[model samples]
Target: MKTSTVLIVILALAVVALVARLFFFSKSTSSAASAVMENLMTRTSIRAYQDRPVEDEKVEQLLRAAMAAPTAGNRQPWKFVVIKDKQTLKAISGHFNTMKMAEHAPLAIVVCGDMDNTYPADGRDYWVEDTSAATENLLLAAHALGLGAVWCGIYPMQERVAYLKDLLGLPENIVPLNVVPVGYPAENPKPKDKWKPANIHYEKWNGGDSAVR
Candidate 1:
């Protein structure tokens, strides 16, 4: 074949290969992104719990997942107090009326943000954010593990916070953020899709698709 014809064929083949690569890469990336979004969307918080208890090993696994969450500057400034003690759990549950659901939970986890452990030399505060991330991880991990969990706020509520502080003998630097009740779910609830396209902006704040509004 002529050299010109040969070169033209080679260039065509290269163009085809490039297009195929781009097409496959785009599909793979889209699939991965969709999977991640689905996982986040499907995760739900459970309120009603069964009488069944969570196994020690499963609880440990959940905690491990919680601690594995990313923290600001990799500073894991969080401590978890696992309350399996029946009396202690009952007492803790009494502090918050909204947390009565915890009464049926076989195990409860008290997530505390430890400023003493999380503070940088500059005295910047990262405890709240770090502890929040940890809490989210715990909740998501619990749902993924076929366990029901609910986050009952505590830190911001002065009465509940003080009660937990006094009851647990927590130091000044340790602040209780939330009490999570974990156990088998007695109720099956589906998660809602809270995605509002209007809330999302692409590139700039071009106001997402009007259909979303």
Candidate 2:
């Protein structure tokens, strides 16, 4: 179930990847962008973490990477809550059944979407999209920095969302998106094989074998 949950979190981000690229990442051959791509490809969800504490400077680096994500209309509507307190982390760990790693992780960043800063577009909220993009950036940054991490979904799951809000003392207008546990890796999980020509169709999606079965 933990593995499936991780995969679900990944799929959710991947679904918005095209939109992310369209708004934030540009097609570039520069060494920096190339290095970023390398990090993206090799990053894997880390579920087990060491007992050591994560440095403050490294936390700042991850936040910087998250803020660098593209926001719709430059709204940049994201509020981050960093959790380091052992009791608080243990409380959160106990509450979220799938996030046992939080108990051992030195840091957990709760990414929230500031509804006050988001505007309704076509009668739909875009805060989720903007915040999710930021979350993906953060995960990548963690991997690049040699810190293991995991993305545990919170928003859209009303019960989990409310629980985190009360635990973290977030305002009603702020919605907790997810909990990211950060620390040195204690376990290394293998990456899934996602490159499939069966799902790829040039020009337009040919309704042939392109369906994800």
Q: Which one wins on lDDT?
A: 2
Relative to the unseen true structure, what is the Cα RMSD of model 1?
5.6
C-alpha lDDT values of all predictions:
0.84, 0.89
| Residue pairs with clashing backbones, model 2 | none
Error of 1 at 73 (Å): 1.8
Model 2 agreement with the true structure over 40-129: per-residue lDDT tens digits = 788999989988888999999999999999888888899999999999999988988899889999989999999889856662378888
Estimate the TM-score of every prediction: 0.77, 0.80
> How displaced is residue 112 in candidate 2, in Å?
0.5
Task: List pairs with backbone clashes in candidate 1.
Answer: none
- Alpha carbon deviation, residue 55, candidate 1 (Å): 0.8
lDDT of 2: 0.89
Q: Stretches of candidate 2 above 4 Å error?
A: 1-34, 211-213
